[model samples]
Target: MKRWIILDRDGTIIKDKNYLHDPNGAELTEGAADGLRMLAGMGYSFVVLTNQSGIGRGYFTEDEMNAVHLRVDEMLACSGVRVSGWFHCPHRPDEGCSCRKPELGLVRRAQEELGFSDADVAFVMGDKKSDLEMAEALGAPSVLLMTGYGAEEYAKGARGTLNCGNLRDAAKAIAEFEDGAARASFSRDLREHAEVVSAMRSLEAQAGAAASVIISSLRGGGRLFVCGNGGSAADAQHIAAELSGRYLAEREPLDAAALSCNSSALTAIGNDYGFDKIFSRQLEAHGRAGDALLAISTSGNSANVLEAVRAAKKMGIRTIALTGGDGGALAREAGLCVCVPSSATPRIQEMHILFGHALCGIVEKTLCR
Candidate 1:
């Protein structure tokens, strides 16, 4: 759903001028255009409602007012801000017209045309008390800007969305309010993760099997090597750290290292044998019959990770894979593979860390004791 902003034109958007008529005189208030663009990016659309007494008072023609509005729109277009509706109450205050500020005529008319109701309005904003009054009529929130005649209203103790200094400040205030509202409620993101993990219960047997492979390799005085690419690469180093540092124990640190941790070797090998050989070349120099290599890839098909798995096997080193979905070629090639049920990369990565933690806990209990 599109969030809507009920806005006053002159003082709220452009510098308020006395009977603004000339298109050339239509200048945007400082930071107003940028703020509108920011709000627009956040899914807020605008409908400009203004009181133009200059037309009724014979100060400017209706055609002249439209020309000026067109000019303002041109300037706003440079910043990618498009006002959805343009409305003006061309009557003097003494005329007692229903379309003027503090009245609901124009706003109601906009609702009819724009397919929005008072409840759909996000906030009403202007540099005048009448603008806030418009919001009060709709029972919506309001923002009082410190531009144009707003200073006078502020001096008179008129409060809005906390007396914004500019449109930029007003936009920031609205965003902060939204963020606070979101934080106060339960997010759907945690629910998504819960669903992914709930589905992973079926992987229990596979995870236990993968953990057993690593434990047996370590128990025989064999080191564990881990490697991946991108986020998985970070996960590799993280898993290695848990094994090498201390996983809830005072025992000696396990012989575990992330092959990608050595930048010098990675770059030299990558430069010589190519990017595909970086992990495989590192495994060649370190792998033994008892050592185990943990290859992690969200897609289960990373070329470099596959190369590393193949090289570990050729050197008589045990291979274990952490992957997702159909488990790709790595699943079939590795000695053991724990595949996450989800096909989404983010969920797969999350499960990888969870499995990594489980492995750390399992091996620490057996090896440290």
Candidate 2:
């Protein structure tokens, strides 16, 4: 489904220059470009709906208004952001045009042109009451930013709108909301699956098996190497940090490194040998016989992660894989494969972190004693 972010141009995206028509006068509000980029990453397309009354009042030409929009687009493009649509209501307040703020003409046009019918899923964002009114008319949620005339609007009792400090904050809030919704859906689905329950029952046994190898490796004075990609990359670093520092007890730091943490080495190896070789090369340099490699992958089939696992095996390092969905190839290759039952990425990741924390806690208790 195509979700739209309907934005008010002057105060929401750029500094409000009273009736801004000159391209040179257009300046992106701080973090505006980044905010739009964040929304773009979340699959929301932007449509700027602005009220350009200056053109209607004969204060500026329609051409001048277009030039300003061009400037805005150019600025946003520098950050790899693009505005999917540009709409304007160029009529005076007294003209009684239906396309003006608080009216649904522009939104209707957008719906007809863009081929989207669901208004409830769309978001309207601006710094004025009229924008909120428009959203209400369309049955869409609205976000009011405290940017240009926002303070005055708030003082005038602009209620029933989500208020934000800036566009960046609004973007982050929306992303979080989306993620929460996804997790909720995943949780509901997981409850109906008997396999997830079965998987939970096996966690203790799996953790014990993996913990035994990890504890023996550390006791033998060998280090731990961890690697993954995307969300798993973050999990890799997080687990490595917990092990190298203290997990739940105050104790001496253990030797652990997340191969995915070094951007310089990652880029150098990727550029020189290819993306699949990045983790493998890092493992070759840091991994040794008797050490342990903790490989995290939601699918358990990422080329880079698999390569690292193979490298660890070749180096005589014990390999542990945290994976999901039948555990892919890593389950067969690794010395210990702990597979989360759910196939959904978010659910798998949640289980991966939980498993990591448990293992870290067990290791901490053993080593500290």
Candidate 3:
């Protein structure tokens, strides 16, 4: 996947010249080209999201803007840097346009054109509150450069963004942070394995019971429906796949499906009945008495997952909760609760998959026999 940095143009990458329409007047800001080049070397691409109210105010034409952009491009080329996209909003503030700074239009357009979005970006970088606001909307981190209006904005208490002072410092800080994260995650995972082991050990009977519940349903030819949200959704799919497809040996395919796997049904249900009904609505359609649901949730508090559990109970379907931190309300609600005894999310997730494998193994061994 292409990692991106959604950047600002004027007052960020170039010296702010107060709506100059002349290409000859354009200048690269201090450390702008070099900083961009550093990030490019690290396999990062750039998208320029800017607000050019000058165009709407009739201070510059689109053709003139293009010429100035071309000039900026030449300067960037000197540093061996290239931007993947240039997205700007040409609307006055009073126009109430969606594409302006602090709005998401420019960033959204860039995401569409570039085939990447917030999930693929490292961070947004700019010298103003608008840039930070855009990053906030995308749910991505942002770099606040103390260039252009950055110092002024900072002085006025624009917080919650990484203030790296300037383009050069920002690049170095990002590089260091990335490097540190990469180095730490390896050791962190290893150290956290003890938590997983302890959690798993503490829940041996619960794990076996969760498996036996599914085995009984499978023996009775009942389908299994799994549901979760976000990362838990992925875990739900993984568990479903292992059962319905295969785990470690050749066997007859089991009946299973992830409620969140069908995008059409999920989206339509979510849109029509609200997000809380997304999973429960599907359960209503496909789940029958004696069928099983393996509801996965790290915190066991996902509204949709809980709703699904309630729906399953009303249908006389059995519910097994795979969750962490005392299993939230799901622990109390489910027929069986395999609570991974850790509050840390990652540790809980690790134990969840382990529990899923154990369940899959037990079911396959019992049924295939």
- CA lDDT of 307 in candidate 1? 97
Order of the predicted models by TM-score, top scorer first: 1, 3, 2
What is candidate 2's lDDT per residue for 248-299, written digit by digit as tens? Answer: 7888999888888888999999999999999999889877899999999999
Winner by TM-score between candidate 3 and candidate 2: 3
The whole-model C-alpha lDDT of candidate 1 against the native structure comes to 0.90
Q: Could you tell me which 10 consecutive residues in candidate 1 have the lowest summed lDDT?
A: 184-193
Kindly report the root-mean-square deviation of model 3 from the true structure over all alpha carbons.
9.1
Reference-based lDDT, residue 168, model 1: 88
By TM-score, who's the top model here? 1
Greater-TM-score candidate between 1 and 2? 1
Q: List candidate 1 stretches off by more than 4 Å.
A: 1-12, 15-186
Candidate number that wins on lDDT, 1 or 3: 1
